[model samples]
Target: MAELQGFVFPRTATGRSSILPAPPWHYSGDLLTIEYRTDPERVIELLPDPIEPADDPGAVALVWADWQSCSDTFDELLDPVRAQYKEVFFVVRGRYQGEHVSRCVYIWVDKDYALVRGHYQGYPKKLGSIHLTRPVAYGKAGPRLEPGGRFGATLAAYDRRLAEARFTITGTADQGGFVNSHAMLHTRFLPAIEGAQAPPSLHELVTMKTVDVDAGPVYVGDADLTLFDVPGEEFGRLAPREMIGAYYRQVGATFVGGTTVHSYDD
Candidate 1:
């Protein structure tokens, strides 16, 4: 018998790094997103130093996505249940290291594996219930202009509704690539182990970016948003000002290794 490499290990016996999956996680999914304006001052207050909210209009994009993700290896694709999951996140157009970028304010997922993997990549992901709905109607008189053809998504946690987004496809354009080109920045933090006196815990705040993005068929539309009073929900702070635009599309991307841009503590 030959030795098997890259096999899963028990987390209790070995730390998360013991069974780390190889790089270039691949994902394909339908994304329904809404761009809206919000108060710039509030948005700025929420951002970390060196990351400023966009000066254009404090634009915030909220997305609800249903995705099937797997490692680069083909064998992993056979397990659909382990690969499928739902996500809802809010991102603000911001400036990072003097460059325009999109920074995630809050994000949630329904899968434990995703939660762990996302956190490792600096995505501030929490466990929650995310429900995404696709438009059932197609062709002319497509979902955009029809009264009941809207795509929607809802986020809830601890039995409390956090937010909801509804969008109707109005048109299609080749600009999907442009709209999805923004680089995403997230913070990664690992606390120091307790009772370790020598080197203090890892308290540094780091930034990570996504690469090799391939966006598919972007549909433009109008959307309406409703935010609820969830105690810990950060999305409630922005308070939608006006609808900028809405979109529905499919995207495939490889989330390879990330580069650390800034460090907060030493």
Candidate 2:
């Protein structure tokens, strides 16, 4: 579900101005990976002083999302915007019931609209509109289904609730460190269509890292991510930085990291 998880919400924004400090953690590398989206020129402006690409560093990566290659027909509409702004990102969530999931995304902001392309299970959805909203509801992030089963009703309600909510990128950190973003969205857990029961619990871990550029020792973060399955009521929490580290000393991020990567798996 890595691919799908990454595609969960794109081009949405929350206007709230709140900052949460990055959880204290350590990784082997110093390089940082981010879900970067802004005008290419703006990126250059934010470059650190004495701006020079790392020696023997990796390629200056370009983020691009494709709406045309999806199983879902909505992609065609989203492709046009992607052509304009040129935003792309990838996320790789871990195994879910033994299946690997990955998420890929493309985003662009234009004079008249915000365009976004997302892929999951090869199904793509593109959203376009004149006035873009940040931290848009996850329910509004993609296509919606017509009310059908109990699960369907449940999801519809979740979407309705998320629409009026708010979110903010409180802070961002490196692989070895932690990122803390305060997001409020109506969330629910749906069972698989084939009678599979929902996992006893649900967890979320967002990791951003690079692969080859600043490679070094790896260290996991320490803070836990809290997932409120039912808003206002705590459903569950995932503390991978601690849980994973407890088992493997060197599994997390390390300083002088290599490449940029983001992940969110169920």
Best by TM-score: 1
Top candidate by lDDT:
1
**Lowest summed-lDDT stretch of 10 residues in model 1?**
7-16
Candidate 2 local lDDT, 72-167, one digit each (tens)? 233323654322321222221222223332222212222122222112112122332112122222565532112110110011123322111111
After TM-score superposition, the amount by which residue 70's alpha carbon in candidate 2 deviates from its true location, in angstroms, is 18
**Would you list the C-alpha lDDT of every candidate in the order shown?**
0.73, 0.22
Flag clash pairs in model 1: 144-169, 192-201
Model 1, runs deviating above 4 Å: 1-20, 135-148, 176-180, 194-200, 203-212
- Stretches of candidate 2 off by over 4 Å are 1-82, 85-100, 103-121, 126-165, 176-266
TM-score of every candidate relative to the true structure: 0.82, 0.19
TM-score of 1: 0.82
